[model samples]
Target: MLRVLIIAQCALLSGVLVAEVSAADPGSRPNVLLIVVDDLNDWVGCLPAHFRANGYETAGAGKIFHHYQNHPSSWDDFWPSKNLQFPPTHVPAKEYQPAFDRKPRPRNWYMDFNWGPLDKVVEETGDWMSMKFVSQKLQEKRDPSADSGQAKPFFLACGIYRPHVPWFVPRKFFDMFPPDRIQLPPSKADDQPVAAGPTQLREVDAR
Candidate 1:
């Protein structure tokens, strides 16, 4: 089942990264290679049901799941989930931030339809580099079961950090798609229907 989440920013940033690498043994247990990328919307390719599914069991993403029991390792040991814990609890950014509160810069709306990297780019190394390293090694990296003599399945997770803030991308990649070749997204010149009546009509008389 496909699911979409629309934040306060209208359209969902719906990019996901999921790839599977299994061994030859028909009965071999799967070893998960989890490379979890963050902040990317749904434009990434071959993204399985990740935002919803938990772990290497099968991907599907909607929210964070840290239930270790669900994804046991080949050793039958429970894995621990880690988070970037700076504070004990969540606090308003304006209140807690020391130097750059919310952020030093404003969020990119991508309204200009601009191509290529920003003047001051965000992702310097680029996700492609990271993905290439992980994608190539999944098969070779799988652990062998001591008794079984077969390669175990594994989850290879990689994190793609940008396309979020600065919307930085390398110029060579942008050149692949020329403006003339690109097709515009469908649109309606007129206003579309809305389920919620305008606040004006619902609350006050409009002269």
Candidate 2:
């Protein structure tokens, strides 16, 4: 009876079933590493510009490093030397305008230095490095019999936030791309068309 039901379902959803079946499996549920960087353009070593600039210094270096180093290392080690040199904490420059808090009260609350919100979430929630942490915490709750063993092939995600506004990265990252060397995008001629709406110009002239 169950076989007949499954066959009918498969006939109805043949496309979906075919896709699921044909999907590549790297064997034993291959580990996934999802690294989400906030507002990060494709400026990493993997990109073509990096190769043009650095001449593939670290190309295929990961395979070599992984073979040598033990499993699970600091996230910083994976990055280039320049990236690792970020300031322990970032401080905005004098000309910088505060986006969140405009007017000053007592202390510069917004300007005050601290790791961004996502970092706090990782530290508070679980071990930032371990892939097994997710399986144990997130998956094991629903199914007590579910394998939480480290050998059960896993996934890990490490998110690094920087090079965003306030431009508060390490002095080294800033120094790496000097203003003279930096390539600016071509300016479009009158790209922003003004929308026809209420005119404040008359009121301003009257004042």
Candidate 3:
């Protein structure tokens, strides 16, 4: 019998769920599945590596770490490999539009900040590809024949890189919230200076 432990870590939410197998004899080591979002950037030490060293197969897919920072030894296998850490961007059709004016911005601004509904399907995105890879790993019931050939515990990590920047989700999601029914909080003039402070600084730095 095999036991499973699911650890879900999203933006600000962290949870652990222990699932017991139906068989009477529980396995020695329980498989661990860690699902991370942008929070993966905060991981200084790789938990998967620790588990790997302790006789568990470790595998990962997607943005487990920041593009610049990666612990290769952490996983026995990983998607996109080391050479191609950041996957190709998914460009939508010409008809699909951006939320912003698409005007030139200052170099000081590192990440592109914008929001809009994409005309493209979710499957076209790199995240979806990584998700499919991880999904395949999760469906594996036993180790490969090259290995011990028995049911082996594994430490699997999946990183979802959505709800972060560029906010270009599929139109289906946006349609769920009708524009007419949406509401915005009351705004004060006093808050404008503080809110626009960052933008002003970027403009000044560019010049």
Cα displacement (Å) at residue 177, model 3: 2.4
- Where does model 2 exceed 4 Å of error? 1-95, 98-157, 163-166, 183-185, 192-207
lDDT of each: 0.29, 0.28, 0.52
* The 10-residue segment with the lowest total lDDT in model 1: 1-10
lDDT, candidate 1, 1-207, per-residue tens: 011111111121123222122212223422221212222222341232232233332211111221111222211111122332011111223322222223332223221121233232223344444444455454345434333644334434444434433223555556667769999877574654341122112211111
> What are the runs in model 1 whose C-alpha is more than 4 Å off?
1-125, 142-153, 157-167, 177-207
TM-score of each: 0.27, 0.22, 0.57
In Å, residue 60's CA in model 3 sits off its true spot by 0.6
Query: Which candidate, 1 or 2, would have the higher TM-score against the true structure?
Result: 1
Residues 1-207, candidate 3, lDDT per residue (tens digit)? 012112222211222122222222223322222323223324433466557767888877777654334467677878777445445445332333321224344433324443456666878677888888788887663435545556558887777777666556788889899878999778675677432433433321121
TM-score of 2: 0.22
Best by TM-score: 3
How much does candidate 3 score in TM-score?
0.57
Better of 1 and 2 by lDDT: 1
